[model samples]
Target chain A: MIVARIIDSIWATRKAEELNGFKFVLGEELTSEGNGKRRIVAVDIVGAGIGDRVIITTGSSGRKMLGDENIPVDAVVVGIVDDDCNFK
Target chain B: MIVARIIDSIWATRKAEELNGFKFVLGEELTSEGNGKRRIVAVDIVGAGIGDRVIITTGSSGRKMLGDENIPVDAVVVGIVDDDCNFK
Candidate 1:
């Protein structure tokens, strides 16, 4: 999982069926060696909030978080990182 | 999932318990709009080879590929691309 900071919460009045109860967060990926300019939207199943450093899962495994491979989601927040962990 | 090219295979004689019997491959993520310079390590369950473009799932969702969410892996190869895919 890559380290990322939640930038904001995303709201979609109309979305796919499986995403109904899931919280979505906008985030910018973080890397220890270089700039992490890639922005992505991820489902927050771990209660991550804005400014929280989180571990995100992407792709089919991301879809699998909701128990289905057909879920439209490509990213999901699986863990919130503690300040003490050295990301490097 | 992100599209990436398998750069080479990875070998670890000693590894985490959940990672045993798994094939590890090194890869570079691909993007249609810009340079794909991000390098990553991924588990290959789909038979992707060196130089083959493949789809990868990352993070906790990535760990879920083995049916258990406790796997030590962070990325996984889920698909191989053909020549016809319009990645854009």
Candidate 2:
């Protein structure tokens, strides 16, 4: 799991059928210092918006969050953080 | 997937039961310029050794490579790179 901030939303007309109904967002990892350089595209399962700090899960655990094993996604936003003093 | 070089092997006397028969190696990610700071502990399934550049798959795909979805592993070395024009 990683703590990140949603930076932007992604839209693609032509993608794998399994990804059609999902909303994709770009997230930048959050570290104790600030935002880290690692960025990833993740499915927004928790209705997170831009600038929202979120908890992202990767790999099979991510796909399992969507209740399907066949989705072609490796990262998913599982939760939105209400408050955090660790990162700015 | 990511390209990395095996830096060292890891030995753990106490670990999860599902990881008993697997060999874990420390890998440093490789970039076009040189080695990146990102490092990971991965189960080596392709018999890779130190100094070998290898391809690693993460998540469920990695667990699937070992033919066991129940393994508590997120990364796995799937192949060793024979030759490459890029990266130092």
Candidate 3:
């Protein structure tokens, strides 16, 4: 898993069925040490934007973002941080 | 840390007063064992679709999705999987 922040979101008028009722957000990639990275990506969820702390999933886990075995996905945000996280 | 997939994306013209450009996806939460979980949540990222494997970060990492203290968010997609993940 990775750390990041939802920077923004994009809304598409026409999309696939797999994207029905889904949400997306733009986030900056953060390292495990809790530092920000240079790359930025978009997420498909809701209630996140422009400065909220967040958790991101990468790798195969990211591919799993959708289970239709058809939708082409690479990354995904799984959980939202309710408060400061403790990994100790 | 948790694993999930980006199921879908949603677009809203009249959004929270907080949301501006965030993307959202409905993903089925997955456990560390590589198995899908019962609970399904929305993610915020793009370029991801159903059936695509993905990785997700939880806890404080999520709150950082937006970086904004005003918007309310819990999770955010950070990275897109090019292939599979290997943790050792």
Candidate 3 regions with alpha-carbon error over 4 angstroms: A1-88, B11-14, B31-36, B86-88
Clashes of 3: 104
- lDDT pick, better of 1 and 3: 1
Kindly list the interface RMSD, in angstroms, of each predicted candidate in the order they appear: 8.6, 9.6, 13.9
Candidate number of the best DockQ: 1
Model 3, span B1-88: residue lDDT tens: 3345566666678878676777766666543334435444544554567665454444344544445656665555544444433321
Off by over 4 Å in 1: B1-88
In model 1, the Cα lDDT at residue B62 comes to 65
lDDT of 2 by residue, B1-88 (tens): 4557899999999999989989999998764345345898998866888998765657775665455678798877765655532322
| A1-88 per-residue lDDT for model 1 (tens digits) | 4557899998998987877888889988764346756888988876777998776656655565466666688777766665554423
Fnat for the candidates in order: 0.08, 0.10, 0.00
For residue B37, give model 3's deviation from the true position in Å. 3.3
**How far off is residue A45 in model 1, in Å?**
0.5
lDDT of 2 by residue, A4-61 (tens): 8887765544333455587777677787776344666678988898899999988777
TM-score top scorer: 1
Q: What is the lDDT of residue A38 in candidate 3?
A: 32
Q: After superposition, how far is residue B38 of candidate 3 from its true place, in Å?
A: 3.0
